[model samples]
Target: MYAATTIGGGLGTGLLSFYLGIGVAALLRTMFGYDAWDRDFNATIGYIFGLVGWLMGVGMWGTWGREWFGLKIKDPHANSRKELGWQRYFMFNVDHKVIGIQYLATFLVVFMTAGLMAMIIRLELMGSGQDFISNKTYNTVLGMHGIMMVAVAVAAVVGGLGNYAVPLMIGADDMAFPRMNALSYWLVPPVAVTLLLSPFLGGLETGWTAYPPLSVLTDSAQTFWNVAIITFGLSSILGGLNFVVTVMFMRAPGMTWGRLPMFVWSMFVTAWLALLYTQGFAVALIMVTLDRIAGMGFFDAERGGDPLLYQHVFWFYSHPAVYIMILPGFGIALEVIGHFSRKPLFAYRYAVGAFLGILGLSGVVWAHHMFTAGIPNYLHGPFLVATELISIPTGLIFLSALGTIWMGKLWLRTPMLFALAVIFNFACGGVTGIFLADVPTDIHLQDTYFVVAHFHYTIVGGEIFGLFAGIYYWFPKMTGKMYNEKLAKLHFWWMFIGFNLTFFIMHWPGIEGMNRRIADYPESLQTANLIVSLSAFLLGSSFIVFIYNFINSWVRGPAAEANPWGARTLEWQTSSPPPVENFLTPPVIAGHPYDYGVPGAAPHVTFFPPAVGSPAGGGGGGQ
Candidate 1:
């Protein structure tokens, strides 16, 4: 059944690509003569051909099923797990845990590669002017850094950890569509590889923003980047769909909507944002490709194409993209807080409300990213109000965090430490974001390092910290081993300090008018630049502790119990590194996931042992 769906989807995507390609070609030929065989036209044709060829290959292998010419058909079941070896990782498996690990491993590889690009950018900025590479090379490197980091941030939580943990947390065997989950994850590598090799295709100089006019005139890197982006976007869309369906349809018996785990809620909201906005970016990129390859003039200013149109379409997705990145972190922080504090989530209803509010507000804030881009003055007020209103929902997140920690036992463990760091850094990021959202202030800070510092604080401080929290919180559950407490704490301190040292100082540079994306800076700012460069190196090296700790712990750490944190979530009820089918017998839900305490109640850990025929104590069983 899974194989058939996989083959059918692939074929459908392929056929759609073919018709779109031919249609585009026909339009070009009819508008221009055959003599107008331009670079754009050739690139478009090549892209379509590649898509068609890939689909045809999949069809031939799966539908035709011929191993050799005139050979007898082999039984599909002939080669079982014994024959597959490690090759199963390359194919779709129904196991959600396996898919999770796949996401984790792939994103780690991409993260490392992108991190190296950051190192190169820092090296060039180490001194007053460009030293290691030319300005063009430096710009390309920086562009790759931005684009790849965006990919990493977008995928790290949702694709990597979320894929692995959400189903388990919700007490489901797998995603509603396990095969589709596998497909989404598998799509990542090819896109990542393409982006990595973009430099060889002359490197895209428009930064990750890929703003037009400039993008249209750039080399093949644009083509490669566009296609790669489209592919990645498709992966996001599929993943989003799977998540939405799984959360809605696959919760264990008695797991009511209000009883859902915070992380699950976070994933649900993030998935909605992804579903809503991913297609916009996909469409915008597709149009850009049409303009570049077919001379369609969609964004070509001189040929009646409006350059501002690109900004509008791009941010329509990109702004929501930020929520997709941070909301998961909010979920992670809430999870960590509940466990470490031994408390129910503070203001649970408000936290959920905040998630929905952010989703609605995300679309309105895109123009905040475009304040200085020749937009009408009247337009700025509406976007600015909508942008500022987001802070109200975002403020609730802080209230939940601070309230949970106020009178509770704070562990200050590696995970908790990262959670604390997330609070501090995200606060700084969120506060600074207000300056950018205000049209008057944004005019001055728009392209400056202030924007850079603001996001790094939010993304790195918020998302990256949350990622570490998840890693530390769920490491045992995922791997059945404990990470080194001492080493984990050490890693946290170094990372926390190094991150601040690197990015905190950047705010001043932005305020002082240091333009972003440039390799060279003025002589007056040399000392600050040097400081940021050195701090960045230290920040980069901080990952060493994490690497050593993760590898050593996986092989040698003490065996982990099912419920390390003693929380009420269903995932903790199962064995560490859970069985292939997840719950050996179906799990029964108990009280709300965050029921840390209730008057006169014994502090007993809840478990739905197989013997208990009735649903666990809490809410009624699922309707």
Candidate 2:
């Protein structure tokens, strides 16, 4: 599909669009200023214009551009299935499954790249005083690692797994808006490329938060970072919106709200979080971008801009963004727990209620990230209370997990193991979070490695582990292949042990007052840092085992049976890897999604193959 024609899906076309954008940017700069050698000006313009041309070159114009202009096209959903082998993955395909695969492949690649960046950071920290890279380079690597991983955390599961699974689970042929789904996904590449290309533009060092004054004074690389963030926010907002509409309107008949799968409910709540709060962070980034490019100085204290104002706007979305990152993880964990334990989700309605409760509390606790930033004294008490109170909903997730596992069959499969690990991991992370939420303790731990350890416990331990659980649990259904379970077990043990050794020990140095974002620490902390670094290397290397297993299994593993786990969700009713239309006819929901042990219960969804005289199975499905 991506031939080298005017409209195709080829790297050559992407490059052509790229160079065209650079040329347009250069031309405009020359016209606007006599001195046109400014790299910042050229880079900003070229980056923006390049993505436009890249969009056109990628067949976006041919697919949705005509639709935007209200013109009809022939076969709008063409090439969605594997009509041309794996090339559909690289093309502008409209199938939710293909898009989901594309997203999974894309973000995993980014994750590995960012992981390499993190290894570089750990190498420097391993020895103390600037082991290899310069402090400036170290800072850049650290910031890039932070932001890229943030991108992975924010988008990987929700965009990748959610997009693929939601339609199938809901018994829909496709997303409520398939074209819009494609659009949301397509926006990601250019923005990711822009952020990845920041190093050549002097790199960004203001950290992922990009607090201003530092951000305002940093090199023009920050401009690209700003644009990347705003662009990503736009994509996230659209994705969240698409998920909500699909879930709310397209579920299988008899699948009431209470009958919805935990993962779908999680996505539904996550979508609301994304829709309502993502713009706060986007607006903050936009203001900073304007400060960099347009000289607006919204955060420049010298220009009467309050730097604290940036923190307020940034954290409003960012703190909720923490929930945005983990809520889906919670859903995934519960889904795995219920399936593998041979039980219905414990307190299903309460868990659903807790998800909503978390969303309601997410916004009020934003101020907690700013407690030590010199807010009013009276406000601190309420903020602290709100932050601590959010943990009630968080605890309910754990309660449900424990309750479900009590006296259950407890299949210790890869997914279940990882699911169980999530509870353990998030427990440690959440306990520390309570300490951090208290004003007195936070004052002591502020800017220390304790904070770092706390978040990694939540994000890496909680979210990433949950991500792997989802990947393993859904692997058979998504790809029609069984992963090497032994290798997956090895991956889990290596990662779990190494993860604890690395992050758990990391907290001591913080308690000993090791500040974060620093190139060097006290000589006394060197042994601790080295141990953390070495274990981190081990933790990082465990991914190598996973990658090999993921690839080797996808190509050569045993074929999976439909409904391998005997899952009761609507998705497992369809074929493994699912058909192009998901269901030949719309699935008829019969009962609760996770009523696994219920005696004499019908399947959640019953599938009938396509009628003999109908179009049947030529990748024939509706939008």
Candidate 3:
């Protein structure tokens, strides 16, 4: 049954739908005299419909479509194979584990693709002139890289680790809406296609923000980018909704609010932030698309549209979007800290409070991004105060992390090292952000390499570092194999050193008056540009080590024990890769989710003894 809806089916159906849509649009234009629409308009609509077809052809209909029509159905047995085969990942399987791996694998490819584009950008800037690619091509590459990496930062952890670990940690067999979860994931591939396909439509150069007036007037490819962003946003919203429902209503029998793992709590809070704020960005993009396709005057300044209105709306979500990216990193870091340090989470309640505080403050602080754009002078002080105040909640995260590792059994594993690096990098990001928050400092640094360095430190250094930590920390459980520790450490040091060396020096050029988004720069900035570019190349190459370690370890490394880390989370209470149903039986919650350092602390959960000959009875269950 599942064979019909393979990856090939998805690609074929999507391509057929796209061509069919173009054909129908052409017919309408020629035969029916509907000549107002151009090829770009038709292409945009075609891509949207093609995405629908792709999802339908990817087997979403099997799990969700039949049930939607009230059809009584038997189990499709999609993931019935005891061994986790690679094919299940290619098709739509309702298993959370499969969905998680799908998200991770898909976005890692996107991340590396974007990283390659970054390499091109760095290479172009290396000689301080048009050495390689044309300036037009550079802008397009920069825009593409920005949007693609934003998609990765937004989806990789939440969609990947959040999907795989959240359910098991909460002792739920799966998410509350399994089909919705799968649908959210299936929505991403078409987005990737649209982003990559845009250059063919004449390319876009407005950068990831796509601020209109410029966006309203750019190449028709902007239409493709618009649709891609809207699609990705929709996927994010649905995924967030699933996390909220699952965490709220799906915990095990004795699991309670206070006892939830810090990571789960972060996910819960992050889901609400995603649910509430993502709509603003989505609506902003839709309005811009309408301006392009329907002549809607929402952002057209000549049409009496307010360009700044678009900025207001974009940053309304984008600023909070930063929090959305970093909050999970915070949770993952703290989770690693507690386990490796062999200590209870320091100031657990305060950390949770800080999360809540960050969420509350996020919505009001959007105007800080607009300080240099001539936002009301009267409003400047308030925005500055609001932006500066956010550090208090953010500071709690660092304090908790440092306090947890203070004088404890600090295990400097790959994950812990990455977690520690997150602190250093994020501190750099946070301090620089304070400068950007102040109107005076922002007037100096806005749109410079300083701005770029600041955000990369925050997002790449903070979120990506945490992402690596979570991946290494959970690799044992996810793959049921121990990664090569030497290679892993080498990957860590190479990336960490390379990342800092690249971005850290970028501040000097920014302070010395180097503007971003331009391919060429002054002769005086040449030496700095050369160094940064070379450092970036080395930073980019470190992932080669990571990719090798991930794949090699998965295929040939030693088998992992279920409770290799001896953490007390519910996920660790199950098998290394976990059973198809997650546990031998529904687990009975035993105590707090993180109870390290407390004498005689109980295990977080205990599974019922499996019936005779069950997989759990065969020793796949946790210790």
Candidate 4:
């Protein structure tokens, strides 16, 4: 089944490519008097021919010969157990759980590689001047770190845990389009490898933003960066489309829009944003690639292309991309908040409204990223107002969180610790964001470490903390074993302290006008640089605790019971590391997802399969 799907997709893509190539050649010949037959044209034709040949071999011949010759073809309906072997990890598998594990493992690998780059960066910044590597090498390391972390942020939770758990939690058997889900996961490896090897192509120096005129004139790595980013954007779009379709079409019988898990709702909004905005980044990168490869002038300042135009297009996607990265975190925090509090989520309707509102407002405030790029003064005020207004909805998230945690039983498990930490860190991050959103303050903080510190507080503080919370909360479900609570707490504290120590003082440097993306700073700031670098090393080292906790817990920790958290969600009703099909029998919804304090009534009821020992084939009593 997987092979057939791959071949069909390849053929479709090939036929489309062939037509596009022919059209391009005709346009060139007709408009510029260029010859229709050229070496480049022949190469394109050859590539298309190769694609067609591969498609024929895999799809037509493989399928027909297997049927006619009575070959003992592999069982498509074989149990998922055999399908989940290590070999299948190399190929496309329709199992959302398997894909989730794949995404988690893949991003961990990339995260470690990026972490190594970060170590190099810390080493370089250990003193005021360069020590271990040259400025160019430092720049490359920094650039790779930025890009890799961004990739991890984008994929880790949504593509990993969300892919694995969202459908199950929502009571669906699988995503609406499982094949596209597989495709999205498969795109990650090639994109990751390309970015990993970009240094060999001449490392990029423009950072992940890849702003215009500089990116256009940069080396081959910049071109590779453009291609890798475009490919990643395509992956995001596919994943987003699958998510939207799945949430909209695949919910179980009784799951209404309001009954949907907050995490799932967050993903639904996030998918919508990704679908709409990623294309702008894709097109912007393609234009940069064209300028590099074909000398097109979409962003070429020399050719009358406005460099600021590239910034506009890039940030249009990226600003919402920030929400894309953090919205799931918001969802995770909300989930954790309710579970730990042993209460219904406070302001559930308001939280949902906020998610949708952020989706709407994210597009309008993207220009805040470019406030210093010389837009007109009148435009700045409108952008500032829009940017500040987003805080209204964003503020609701905090209100909901605080309201949930205020008067309920607070569980301080590893997950809860991370969740509480998310509130604290995000509060700090959010308050600081106002400085960037306001035009007058942004003028001073625009390119300095202040902006860097602000976003790190938001992205790393908010998203990464929320990610860890979700991981610790869902670890048993993913692996069927409990993590070490002691170690997990240790990891949480170390990371929380180290993270703040590293980034908090960074505001001082930024306030003192220390620019970002520089290899060296003045000797006057050496003491502060030393402090930040040391703290960063400690921050990076804290991951060691997480590594130990994850490994030791998976191998040696006690087995977890279903519903360990005593929560009222569909996910906890099933076994730890749920069955192959997620639910043996589709869950029947009976009440709100977070109803506590009902007399003689549990918030949830599990409908078990006959094999699970329910003679009536369904169970309705509370826990």
Best by lDDT: 3
Model 1 gets an lDDT of 0.81
Cα lDDT tens digits for candidate 1, 280-315: 788888888888866699887777889888889999
lDDT against the true structure, per candidate, is 0.81, 0.86, 0.88, 0.80
When superposed on Cα atoms, how far off is each prediction in RMSD? 5.7, 2.7, 3.8, 6.1
> 3 or 4, which is superior by lDDT?
3
Where does candidate 3 have its weakest 10-residue lDDT segment?
A: 613-622
lDDT of 3 by residue, 380-422 (tens): 9998999999999999998899899998899899999999999
Candidate 2 local distance difference test against the native: 0.86
Model 3 whole-model lDDT (C-alpha atoms): 0.88
| Clash total of candidate 2 | 1
Residue 366, model 1: Cα distance from true site in angstroms: 1.0
Among these predicted structures, which one has the highest TM-score?
Answer: 3
lDDT of 2 by residue, 132-229 (tens): 88878888888889988988898998999999888888888889888778878878888787788888778778889899888878874888788778
**What clash pairs does model 2 have?**
2-9
Clashes of each: 3, 1, 0, 0
Kindly indicate the candidate among 1 and 4 with the higher lDDT. Answer: 1
The better-scoring model by TM-score among 1 and 4 is 1
TM-score for candidate 3, residues paired by index:
0.95
